[model samples]
Target: MGYPQVSAREQIIPSRVPTDAKANALEIGPERTVIEITHVGVTAEGRAVKVTIAVAPVHYLTAGYELRSPDTRRSQTDDHASR
Candidate 1:
């Protein structure tokens, strides 16, 4: 078989936030989110691949929030779809 093609990979290339951007803390509000582009590697001889090898801001459940929930229902508690 032949190799796959490098399709268009869309990304949000925002300006790097400074240290004092949010008083030295990345505050992910209820409607806010954060992500990190972990690595960009080439595979199978120049097949470009971008890997976001990181998790969200709230990786751990400090408060009464759950780290992993199977609740697929949509509610006002924690809406996955922002809009």
Candidate 2:
């Protein structure tokens, strides 16, 4: 099998996502977007690989107002797992 040809614009993955994840969410066009996986495979030693056969645009919104309520106290949720 041959590797699929990906365009320069389609190759850019956002920085907020972890490198090990098979797929990631990206914010485009002023909304939250999800990119679904078309195919995924694993090697003999248990290493995983992913392939994106197609992409479609979907619109989503976040409950930012509820998560960022002024009355609620903000706390650090990051556990310093990577850093």
Candidate 3:
């Protein structure tokens, strides 16, 4: 048997920055907040299987000050992964 053909599509939903004073002070900025992925497999029957994935950002920690220190810079994986 051989592997079936597959097609995939991914979309990054746009984000809107909050206008409220408290929200803005919290450093909540415009970021790609949502991602949607769709996969489709094809076979002799025409359409074989379909799958979809929706991803969102999860804030493990919310601090009043920045987490990264000036002495040591850290990768912004948390922000980028959501996109």
Highest lDDT: give the candidate number: 1
TM-score of each prediction: 0.22, 0.21, 0.27
| lDDT of the structure predicted as candidate 2 | 0.36
Candidate 2, residue 60: Cα displacement in angstroms equals: 12
> In model 3, where is the ten-residue run with the lowest total lDDT?
54-63
Find the candidate with the highest TM-score and give its number: 3
The residue pairs found clashing in candidate 3 are none
Error of 3 at 77 (Å): 41
CA lDDT, every model vs. true structure: 0.44, 0.36, 0.43
Model 3 lDDT, residue 68, Cα: 49
Regions of candidate 3 where Cα sits further than 4 Å from its true position: 1-32, 58-83
| Model 2: residues with Cα > 4 Å off, grouped in runs | 1-28, 53-55, 59-83
lDDT of 3 by residue, 1-83 (tens): 56565533334343333335434545544442332234455655565455564333324222253354544433466556768
